[model samples]
Target: MRIKRPVKVFLLGMVAIVLLWVIHSYHFQNQQFQTDRASTYSELPVAATKVVKHAFGEVTIPVKPQRIIVLNDISLLDPVLSLGIKPIGTVSYLPQYDFLFRGVTNAEAAGIEIVGIGNQPILEKVLLLKPDVILMREYQRSLYQQLSAIAPTVVIDLPSLNYSFKENLRFIAQVLGETEKAEQVIAQYYERVKQLQQLMGERLKKIEVSVINVFTDGIIATYSDNETYNQVLQDIGIPLIPALAKQKETSLFLNIEVLNKYDADILFVMSESKNAALSFSQNPLLSTLKAAKNHRVYTVQQDRWWTYGFLGVNKLLDDLFKYLT
Candidate 1:
């Protein structure tokens, strides 16, 4: 067991170096472990158990979403709020559409920040929130890659551009994990429709209904038979005029001459804006129509028609039915 002094000293140095290396490695490993935990906690803001697929592809719906960023579609806010979840941030639209925004007070009370996400939403602003989930519409797929990089994104498909209320509500319900809620809402809506159907069933069955949207310049636009307005009317047992049904199923703009061409028992006019309303109401050309002469013409605001929200649709339908009756 006897060793030279030089060998003893050299061995001691070797042992010291190994001990130092071990300590450094331990600290480094501990720091890295903490960093990893922080990364998980920070980036993923919710306790999620499942991922759901929607019309906009797939998203991981958190067990409870805490920081939801509604990018551009404020219309979807009502359903989320109805499910008892409040969004942290939402985009700002015109005041006329405030009926669709449900979580404004909760967001304000939470000190939630609202950045200018733009009409299309901004990627940098979205990334800053570190959102748990983002909701948009199917038409905004162009931002998919950029949004996905920041957080889970879900896009709900509307009933259609031509407008289908049933499909819009169904898809939105699927995205919110509220297929049952959606069903319930739809069921209630159908019940109302059935009542209206009974009331106007025989009358509408005999007479055709027509909806025309008029702009400031006397341009007349009519809804396709597939549009949500038409769907609602049809569900209530009303039928569209043959000419409108035969026309292409899209948002169509025609001249004032369309009034002479399509003879409808009831005509609903949609004003594109305030100015359009002023012009359409006073147009000498429109005075010749039976609807205009009998003062059966009704003007609907464009914002309510453009937004596809559950509550919004119900309100619009209620108003329409009340007027019709």
Candidate 2:
């Protein structure tokens, strides 16, 4: 059968439109690339530089680096942002929990270019950003030569020493000459923790809470006492389910049959994607959980909760106060 002339004409128009869009996008990106190449390279103005020993080696960095690039997670980005310094570029956060931290944070918000999707960096884009200092975890040492060629790259550990914000922030702040600010941030964070304790009072000791992560790969695990938001929860004085608290490993994976053993007065479920968690919850055994039956199970996006940052931790506290209180 011969196609109708009007429908065929419309289809052809749509195809032409799509083709033009693709061409336009290609040219736009190409032009931007060229523009980036033409831009002036950023350099610190002969400022006082201090030598900080890191994973790679000693790196002499600017006393105050203006165009900062964080190649790792908020472990570094948090200190920078919390200390009132904005980085020029950074890797994207998992699941984008911007909604939960809208007004309270600018962690990965406007004015910050996502130079990488996850842990992978787009070197060209990073080079174009013209960072004065490039910060990354020890795992990213392979890119040290390439990235350092663009700027003074500092290789630091993500947790540094077991996910303590004090040590991590103090070190990064010292690197940036913002140690004073780091102290203030640290004090304030703990102050909030103290406030949480006082706010909840005796009620905190009685409750048994558990935070579990449902991965897209079908791996279900609970937070160890000091992993992820567990530390924060521990600080808030919420007694995690006895079984979860006793585990020495970072991630405690519970079998389906043992769901009853990991019972909690409050269960917080977070995941990489909504579906991963939804699928996990489909198991009939979950219905056996006290929290499940009592309707104390709260599901949330594993964005800031999974991130190691002051702002993220603060947001996690907000969730606890919202849910528990």
Candidate 3:
């Protein structure tokens, strides 16, 4: 009995030592884990950001966004591409009419995926892209919230002005912190315009140019000051028909019976359908117009003719020189 008591006491002492050792090791390990975690996180640098105010609301965005996605082609993508930043993705309604966009770089060839048709975007593709920023026009009011959830989205509600491209380009530049580049681009564009003015000389002031649209449904109409061709014509000191210059609406519907109302010294038709263009050209009444008699009535593609903004205007200049010179 005396030996048993002594052995029990010795065993209890050993057990207590073991418990103490275990507790010490666990505490040391937990502390080492915390220290390592903090050290690892501290090694990475924080990303810088800036706040920008847009049509929808203010949004905080990374200063130099690595990935950008454009939702609207004509209004949004035009300016984004004009600023020289190739987007990660964009939406185009007419992929077949990509010649208008070739000035900026072929969207697919430049690695810009078509997220969806027209202004609509594929949310799943957007999520996979992990874009740092998204640019769009206010035409996508329904999609603003949904896109913002994925990234910092800036919506541009452009005013309906004849010279809206300047404002559009400047606003996009401000959003991207590219004001200097914008100014440079603007200067370059105007320099080209100046060259055109010098090349065309006084003939620009004499000839009355007009843009008409022949819809696929056989509707014939002429564009007013808001059209890209009109904008470029005005910039180069070209005279537009009185009906087009004074008109407020974007398009003026004209009855084919009174084709004289659509007459101009030089006429450019934006034909959406081959059949409609053929019918318009074959109409006996068209021969009565001075443009047709002089062989100055040209049929143009809607996508190429309607594209607006910096690169778009430059493309128009290329066409103008082809026809006029």
Candidate 4:
């Protein structure tokens, strides 16, 4: 063929453009496919019916449970709400500490009914709410038969393991078919923990933090390694005083005379009532402590620290950011 050089050049340019267009189209489609796949996985449909294994045994629960009831353990409320599930009724650790519910705005606004307190739930009140599912601690197993009769009950071994807040959150998530939400909440929590570590810099490792709760009767309570607040402190690399770390129980209570035994760079004193605070301040040993002498003693709310759960831990972290920084 007797083709001109200019014509051949024009044809080659057209071919190159066509090839470039095809490559671009393929890449765009591939990226779109990946985006769609991720979206699908993230919003995967929950099952209609799921059989969950718990302390009591295997129980089938509705995938999207409504009218949920949380009893015995108030800590369960945080995880339930974190999963975007609002319980119809929940127990309080104690009537006096119902203020703890303030941590969850949704719960407060939802006016979530209070059915009972601690392990002493009012069966009549629970049944009246007509809950689809009930979550309770394993210690409440005695009421399982009765609770299950009203709704599918899932018993979690919270007390036995002294499970961390994340562990408990995941357990509740599994029961409610919200494992994805649980993971997301946990990821966000640890991310915040990392940010805290960065903010504190060298101080994170250098500080010795003591957490204590003062009572009206001259008793002092310190957290164990298993407590949720302590777990958060551990995550941020904050060391506890040696005296507290040696305790074998979930909490160690001491008389006011031995307060000096626990020394730390900073002290967090939690008191539930005015009398407790007054008692703590009145103690002569209060002035002798290293943290007090250094003017590093800070008062914290008992409900936020003494309670184990997600919302409380987050609040505690916020306080740490304020105090440590």
Cα RMSD to the true fold for all candidates: 7.8, 19.5, 4.5, 16.2
Q: How accurate is candidate 3 locally (lDDT)?
A: 0.79
**lDDT of candidate 1 over 1-325, digit per residue (tens):** 8999999999999999999999999999999999999998899854654677777666777755567877653356545554455667666554443332332333322544554433457567778878887887677789877888788888766544335655665665565566787788778888888777777656766777778777766688776777656767777877788888787756777887667766567777767567887887787777877777777777775544544555556666776777677
Stretches of candidate 2 off by over 4 Å are 1-46, 94-108, 216-218
Q: Give lDDT tens digits, candidate 4, residues 200-307.
A: 899877889888888888898886788777788888899888887787886778888888887689999988787788778877889998999999989887666655
For candidate 3, lDDT tens digit of each residue in 133-244? 9998777889888999999998887763334777778888888889999898889888988988888888887899878887544467876686667777888888888878
Per-residue lDDT of 17 in model 1: 100
lDDT of each: 0.67, 0.77, 0.79, 0.80
Ranking by TM-score: 3, 4, 2, 1
Runs in model 4 deviating more than 4 A are 1-47, 97-109, 159-162
Task: For each candidate, give its TM-score against the true structure.
Answer: 0.73, 0.78, 0.82, 0.81
Residue 63 CA error for candidate 4 (Å)?
1.7
Q: Model 3, which residues run further than 4 Å from truth?
A: 1-44, 94-109, 160-163
Q: What's the number of clashes in each of the models?
A: 2, 0, 0, 0
In model 1, the Cα lDDT at residue 99 comes to 33
Off by over 4 Å in 1: 1-46, 55-57, 78-85, 92-118, 159-163
Residue pairs that clash (backbone atoms under 3 angstroms), model 3:
none
Q: Number of the top candidate by TM-score?
A: 3
* Pairs of residues clashing in candidate 4: none
